[model samples]
Target: MMGNKILRKIVATVKSESKGINYFSHQSTAADSYVYSILVDETSDISSCEQVSICIRYCNSQFQSQEDFVGFYATSKTDSFTLYNLVKDSLLRLGLSIDKLRGQGYDGGANVAGKISGLQKRLSDDYPRALYFHCAGHNLNLVVQDACQMSPVIGDAMSCLNKVVVYIRDSPKRWDSFNTLLASHEEVSGCNIRPLCATRWVLKLQSVDAFLHTYEVILDFMQTAHSEKSNSASMRSTAFSLLRKLEDFTLYFSLRLLQVLFKAVDPVHRNIQSKTITIGEVLTQVSSLANFLASNASFIASNAKNDDSVAHFTSCKEFASKLHLNFACVPRGVRVSAEDYFCGLYTGLFQTASESILIRFQAKSLQMAENLRRVLEDESIEDGIIKTVSEFYDDWNYIDILRERRQWFNICRHEGLQPSINSLRTQFKSELTYKLLLPNIRSALTLYIVIPATTCEAERSFSALRRLKTYLRSTQTQVRLNNLALMHIHRDDFIKKVDLDDAMNEFIDRTTTRRNKFGIGNK
Candidate 1:
């Protein structure tokens, strides 16, 4: 009894600090636990960097506003059935129903996203409304990984680059020397080297950029290090190996090509990680990147030839333009021709990346998201737009509901509220909009808003998990770890809305009985 009382007090204090004043007072049964962690934007205002919250959308007695931070659980197994059970149990604990679950978002892993018997498939079988979305960031990362592996030269270049990063980063002396050398260079001063990580999608860009920026500095350091008698044989050998690999024309060209290609897609990769980014926006970004790559591929094919001299001239010219150096300084004796480099390797890399992106993100849900955006923003009301949306909802009559809501949509347009798809969705949540489009259109819009475009929110939570449960605090209780993560991740909300006095009072009330029985007085 005493332990339970203390635990409750701790939970209350954490919740109050993380959520805000009166967080528990309005707490109702049948809360939507899924909303608490998913990437659904719940506010009227939209910003790319808006902080997302774990909110519960409920309607037991009456439709209530979104609630924050219900609970968190820890599980070991990640199998489909086990994950499904964990979700079901968490909802049950919160007095929420599986029938109310509207959306789910996961990375593009076979376990979670597999088509035949994945967790998403299993859950969809039971609750068809729980639409599953592949995390846009993960999909992009996979696309890059797949494309990089398509060519032996590109793959070898990446592998050698990783080795160089690891060698420099692993040794303190080498890292310090590298930094000192970088400081001497005018163009690359104050730039720190970034190591590549296989899992982190954004780090690849930074790593490649850092390497390219410090390319000359690194070569000088490696050459100098290789000559020094004080350096270990292994270090000297590794430096010599990396130096030769970096000096190769094919490797350098491939590196520069990848840097440019990834840079074009970086904006899209970043946008999908935002809470405000919608499905339509993600599709648009991917399509734009694909088109950009296709156009570049065509240009390279038309302009560049298979001759070694042309390859050397083109590569050197581009390199000189970027670094502001003379083309005459480019090293001679190139092994690969321009045609092979551009038409053979660069074309494959670009085409593979573009194709992978299109393959992953081009789906019926994406089409529906696009149609929704068109309907809201353009007021197109095209013949097939209604059919597309109806197909999304698995209901033919959904088009009728959309037709009935046309007046409300016109009202929003007249009032100048329809700025974007997201803005339209935000407006649909208003009292006036709800009353005008009441019941049917309102429900449909609610469903649309709840459908997550990416699993960025969940991925963001994992970052919090790492911080909260670091090596030093590895043994912390799962519940307590989760509590701390909630507090840390949602610190903005706590800082703005949480009342310290209210939290203290709640804690006191919960612990008072136990304290009194133990003859402990309030300090």
Candidate 2:
């Protein structure tokens, strides 16, 4: 502060001594040309307490603010006071205001609090109008996790599959040999080899297929195993069974259900632009998907109820019926009015029926008596039952349309449909439900497709963090890091202060050149 005061006095004295130049005036005027807007988000590794955060700020002009390293601090013992003050100080120095904040985004997890807690809530307490959204893509992924956990068989199969994948992947020679074997089977060499990854679903499907194709080779390699030396007969049998179950799961995914879900969720992704998707549309898509899943779930549940001899399973018929009714409750047309029964006018139409409908979900019986009969009756390819059922399972696109012949094959194999026995019936119900509910879902999807609600926005925000926060690697404090991270993330909105020195230099050069020309009588 004292140095700045002394500098100001010196500059003023110099200006007073000058006769023609108004350097300060030129500097002040040039500082007001353009505005830079900034947005911000922060990431921290809480485990190690080796805390670091990034702040990115970008101007409306060419200089986009980014940082690779913004702040670093030991989190093991730091209090919130130090953290909060650090951020405040950094922003103040950068000439950013809490008021200038346009938007905020985060991956709503325990580490990063939601609207109710953490940075967003704190910022909201300060700047009320700051637009905040949870990343939509992240939400979608969570939804997938929820859906998967609902079935234990699927959970186990996935676990076993992961184990096999890890074993093979750990050995390069085994993994390569496995691929080589697959290459020899078909014209396409090793085109089918895919590594199993935990979170990636699409890639996992190809990996499952690769594993199944090279099962024999894998077993042979495993015979000389070291890590899983306890590969007993039962373990081998379970692995093979799990492999088939995975195949079934993959087959089920190939159905249009997952595709439809993707389509439904595509809109409402986080990044806000001019385009916007409406709530009405999102609701419609949800209703359609719900109706479809409910029907299938209902059918499976109902079938399980009929087979009282089987273990625990709840019938979802009531929920399916209720959701089906929900579809009817949706209002159609572009200008949907509340008064319109199909739109929202007849909101009360579903009220009466909604109360009575019950919600039930059940696991279907995989085994059937009739499926056993077909396998015993015929062993040759000429026999219709075995041939038909084998063909059905082999076709990836067949979905769940199982003919009676396939049921006969299951009976012969004595394989109680290891997973969902009511698949065909469930499919029937789902297809019917899909047909009934598609119009509404489609309309809603079309409406919301223009707006992204998924966490793709969160991914984008993190991408910026990795780019900025580069310079302040070691000395960067956690609070400064957090503030800087948020600032640079939203830097696009921050009005960057013009560099007065550069502006003054340009101004002096132009002014001097003009004066010289005028003196030469060239004005």
Candidate 3:
């Protein structure tokens, strides 16, 4: 009991600024903590290749208020499951649910997978039409990865180059020397020796000819390094590997490759600011790109073969099988059924696979469904449970105005029904409406949007963690570290009543004071 009290107090203080919660402990793994799940719908645009995921809870159409966070549990042991449970529990503690969910986006890892048991499957089972979308950017990556692999030499080159980067970056002195040599090059070497970022390399592949012009400068730098230490076989190997890799890179980046890259970047540019994109948009874009690529492959390949230095472009015969696999996974371009989509979205987003299990809880003594069934069949389903479900189904269908043409609802003032309709609208706007609609809409939106999406939105805590654990300072206990991380999440909530900027500034100042007092940066 004493330990428990102390632990609680420590967590409270950590949360004051760190704004995160730790769930790896034995306590968090309990059944109670795993009760709810979080869902997120994600979309990746093929044109620009940016992915966005949205977290939400179900409520009536009129419900439009936003919650700071929502909480739920994932039904599995994967990253998506862990992320969903943590985010959902945290948000629920603050009074949010799936009713507020709007969209979801992801790049489709096992944790973020949109398939069944994948985040999408889980979310759709709970929330209907929560819009499980594949990331277009990821599909493009697959295309590029396949294209690169088609030429074994290119694949080897990329692998070799990646290793070279890792080796140099790992050795600070070597990396610094490499940078210095580039900066000191007397002619046309004024360009900064930029850090080898992954995305930039992909872009470089589109213009291999431009890079080939500067290959000599890199070789000169390698030669100079080798001359400085004649006994360094390691240095010679690195230089030779880098040259070989560049050759393969240049060979692979012909006009065909450039066009394919352009297709992927276009969609990413369109939705850089959006928090989430729908599945329909992603499927449509990918399908179009695949069709175009398939049709133009022969022309592109013919041009590649004519280039004297092209050496090896991915052949049409070799690429067709991979393209077919990608095409098979691409969602059909036809309009998906709104009702079916919504049902799957909610179920996958909100409800855990094990949700229907009662565990130790007994069945309700009061019978409600049978009584409501009569009213549902005969008289109009008014503003009760049946009415809540009815409104939820219709509201969900209308939420994604992008799916179909938007149509306005017409409430004919049929005397008594007018008052009821108005009352329903008013009730729909309430928080209670979200709670009531949970049962019906849970399957459609919960699994995909709620369960896979996370509330680990502590932008402040990440900053704090970086400050605490820098490249120079990297020793800490796992327990203390967990406590510290949790503090980051709580800190966001703690300062909700205070000015966020002021709190962050104060926290920074405190860290600066500690650094100065400890003489931490006095090199």
Cα-based TM-score, every candidate: 0.77, 0.41, 0.45
Tens-digit lDDT string for candidate 1 (54-171): 3333211122222234334554456677766766775565444566565666776676677898878898898775667777787788888878888777778788889988888898
Every model: Cα RMSD to truth: 8.2, 26.1, 16.9
Ranking by TM-score: 1, 3, 2
Tens digits of per-residue lDDT for model 2, 1-523: 2222222432232222211111324442212222111223334442334442323222211111222123233444333344445545655554445454433434554333344555655665676433344433344445544544443433554566567676556568657755666566564445544445665443344555554445444544444443344656665565555444333422222221233333333342222211132222333343454454333333242232212111111112232243221221222343532113221111111121121111111101011112222232333324454445334222111222233335434543574432222332233244544313222221111111211222333345445545544544635554555556545543442314435555445445556675465443222
Which segments of candidate 2 are over 4 A away from where they belong? 1-90, 114-117, 192-523
Q: Rate the local accuracy (lDDT) of all candidates.
A: 0.61, 0.36, 0.37
Ranking by lDDT: 1, 3, 2
Off by over 4 Å in 1: 1-72, 299-340, 371-402, 408-434, 437-439, 511-523
Measured with C-alpha atoms, the lDDT of residue 493 in candidate 3 is 47
Please identify which of the two predictions, 1 or 2, would achieve the higher lDDT against the true structure.
Answer: 1
Q: After superposition, how far is residue 365 of candidate 1 from its true place, in Å?
A: 3.4
- Worst lDDT 10-window in candidate 2: 360-369
Q: lDDT (0-100) at residue 126 of candidate 1?
A: 88
